[model samples]
Target: MTDDDLIARLEQQERDLLFSRFDFADAWRLGSLLVEMATERGLPVAIDIRRGPQQLFHAALAGSTPDNDAWIERKARVVERFGNSSYLVGRRLAAGGRELDASLGVDPARFAAHGGAFPVRVEAAGVVGVVTVSGLPQAEDHALVVEAIERFR
Candidate 1:
């Protein structure tokens, strides 16, 4: 898809993925659903669900390496910092001809403006957490999380 198309998709995802209420149970269900989808598709990935600084669920599927876990952390940081999907942030940066690490002074080690991490918004509460995946291409990773959230919701 074109960058503009991706940007629009991410924006719509951020709006449609909201939860009326999210607790530990919801986190567990969402995390499990993501894992199942990846496994069924034979996608190696690391998944993470977090609220603020608190990690609610995390899993590294078979074939996922330490690097994938690191990507999850960095991408999650992007969502936490911007209160938006990492893909949206990355697309916005690209649209402006800016790089997340360079123009924003964000440490590359701590933040990544890429697909895969998405804000977990609660209705009327704004973003309460993040759900992240790493292993596939950036867009695929983002799509996986989006699909799982849609199913879970």
Candidate 2:
């Protein structure tokens, strides 16, 4: 899809994927659901869920590497910093015809404006955490997290 199309889809995703309630138990359920989906599809992925600086769930499936873990961290940083999906942030940068380095003073090494990490927004509570997956293409990684969250909700 075109960049604008992708951005629009991500925007809609951010708006639609809201949880009525989210907690530690919900994190476990979402993580497990993502793992099951990945295992069933033979997808090599790493999953992570976090609230503020506290990591709630983490898993590295078969074929996933340490890089996947690192990607998850960077992507999660984007969500925590901007309170938006990593994909959406990345797309917004592109939509503005800018790069992360040129548009923001933030170090690219610490935060990535890529897909995968999505904010866990609770109604009335706003963004409380991030759920992320790494290993697939950026869009696929983002889609995986979105699908898992949909199922979890």
Over 1-153, each residue of candidate 1 has an lDDT whose tens digit, in order, gives 887887887898788888999999999999999989999999989999998889999999999999998998899989988899999999999988888884586888789988999999999999999999999999899999999999998
- lDDT for each candidate structure: 0.91, 0.91
The 10-residue segment with the lowest total lDDT in model 2: 97-106
For model 1, the stretches where C-alpha displacement exceeds 4 angstroms are none
Predicted candidate 2 versus true structure: per-residue lDDT over 67-87, tens digit per residue: 999999889989988899998
TM-scores for candidates 1 onward, in order = 0.95, 0.95
Candidate 2: pairs in clash: none
RMSD of each: 1.1, 1.2
TM-score between candidate 1 and the true structure: 0.95
Worst 10 residues of 1 by lDDT: 100-109
